[model samples]
Target: MTDEQQAVCEEVLAGPRSRLPAPLRAWLFRPELARRGQSLGAYARYGTCLAPHLSELAILVTARFWGSEYEWHAHKTEALKAGVPPAAIDAIEADAVPDLEDQQSRCVHDLVRELYASRTLSEESYRRGEAILGRDGMIDLVAIAGYYSFVAMTLNVFDIGVPEGAERPFGRGKARAEAL
Candidate 1:
């Protein structure tokens, strides 16, 4: 690794992710992408108007949407730690609608689901999302989903997996729509 890239990696991963994540490690091959993604991910995750729990929920939805097992493995624990309900996590894993009660969580989930499923929100969904999340929160909600979708693509295309003996949370399967 170039000294500069190594430094960028260290600064971004100063916590439990002692090493670059597998997806980020792959990005080191393209150092600029890694650098920019590190900063963008930080903002999307920590600086977003969405709270930590809501951000994690968006990540979980993206992970499941792409069937990105490594993303799911990494973020499921984080989502739970950040207070995403276990039932919601499980429902996401099973490709079911999570019975979310918090209006923010519900709105975030519906926004992601509607966008991902239809590639555009219905007028009703768009208005509801705008009302529930406001302008900034709504934007952050989509940003988090878009960022994690890229992460999921990296993991899936690279065939990345969690470390050996670690359970794969999302499992290997076609997306729900694909199965029909």
Candidate 2:
């Protein structure tokens, strides 16, 4: 591990949990739901419902774009089990155009690309997304992305290392993988 990563790991482990000041603990190791004021149970329920409707390729693409190893690692297995094809996973990892065969998948791909590229949806992109996802669905999609982006930032800032025996979900280079 890099020096910074090693230091972060040490700090997280060494920091007093019960005895530390509440504000300090919040700053150093902010729990995801605490930051959002939502329970983990609620978030999981929302995620589970949305995951099936979203294109797996889009989710993978977003994870890669954000350089979120935690997001990528968690969702990679989930996507596969949810029936996302191996080729699509490879395409997402390689940053290549995915050959998604369905309309829902295509719409999601477009939405993810637009969201990442512009930080706002274009007229055409918004229209397409609205049509495919409907108003509430579109809102949910954006929320999901926002939620995961927050997670990505947390994982990076806290230097949450991948679990033992877990494949490095980010690309090969250490610097590039950690940049985000």
Candidate 3:
């Protein structure tokens, strides 16, 4: 690695995460992009107005939508750690409606689902999401989805998979909807 790239990698290693994430590691070919992308991911994942669980729920939905195996494998643990129910996560992975009992989680899921399905949100979804998340939180929620979708695309395009012994979310004939 070039000195610049090594510097960027060190910066990433120094972040809250103990190691470099796959997406940021991939971005290291262009060190500037790696630095900026990691910064954006940090804010989206940790600095968002939405609660950690809500942001993680959006990320899980984005990973499922993109069929990004590495993304799903990584964030599923984070989602669980952030308090999203395992049943809800499994339902999402299976392409079924998660039995989300919390209004914020339900709102986040509905907004992301409707947007992905129709490429836009209905007025009802908008209103409900806004009511639950507030204006700033709603914006952060969308940004979280958008950012993770970018991460998912990077993982998918580069053919990144989970590390050895880690489960493949959509691999090994775990059938779900084809990637959108």
Candidate 4:
């Protein structure tokens, strides 16, 4: 691992809540905790919330878009446990088009694709998304993406290595060495 990655790994394992500079630690922890709290809050308000609503396929796509091995590694099991079809999970990891046969699954594919590709929704995409998810669901979808994007960035920036005994999220091929 690179020096930077090693440092990140140490910090993450140590706990971002504890490792943050003393002055900022409290605020950072509050917001981090609240983000999770609010996710739960939103779920409570809506009968079926966050993970179930967003679906594993969408989460996997977001993981791949950010090249976040950690997120992918973590979520792969969640996806499986949540009953996400294996084929869909495999397609997302491979960065291939999802073979969803239903409108709901297709909607997720479209939303994730548009968000990752442009970071902005086109009018048509927005309308279709709204039709399926309604306004609140749409907002939640964006939140999920935004929240996970932050996660992916943190993992990448810190070069947080995958836990031992975990399967490699990026498949069996080793990443090409960076040229100096």
Best by lDDT: 3
Q: How do the residues 52-170 of candidate 2 rate in per-residue lDDT, one tens digit apiece? A: 63634555777788776766786788688877778888888877777888777778777887798899998988898889878776876776666566656655665554555677767
lDDT at position 78, candidate 2: 67
Worst 10 residues of 1 by lDDT: 171-180
Worst 10 residues of 4 by lDDT: 18-27
**Error in Å for residue 82 of model 1:** 1.3
Off by over 4 Å in 4: 1-53, 171-180
Write down the TM-score of every candidate: 0.88, 0.71, 0.92, 0.68
- In order, candidate lDDTs are 0.83, 0.61, 0.86, 0.64
CA error at residue 82 for candidate 4, angstroms: 1.5
lDDT of 1 by residue, 1-180 (tens): 789788778877784345566677678778889888877787887788888899999999999899888888889999999999999999999999999989989998888988899988899988898898898888888889888888888888767776667887756643333210
Which 10-residue window in model 2 sums to the lowest lDDT?
17-26
lDDT of 2 at 121: 98
TM-score of 4: 0.68
Best by TM-score: 3
Q: CA RMSD for every model? A: 5.0, 8.3, 4.0, 8.2
lDDT by residue for model 3 over 39-134, one digit each (tens)?
A: 898889878888889988999999999998888999999999999999999999998999999888999998998888998888888888888889
* Residue 161 Cα positional deviation in candidate 4, in Å, after optimal superposition: 2.6
Regions more than 4 Å wrong, model 1: 14-19, 173-180
Q: In model 4, what lDDT does residue 67 have?
A: 85
Q: Which scores better on lDDT, 3 or 4?
A: 3
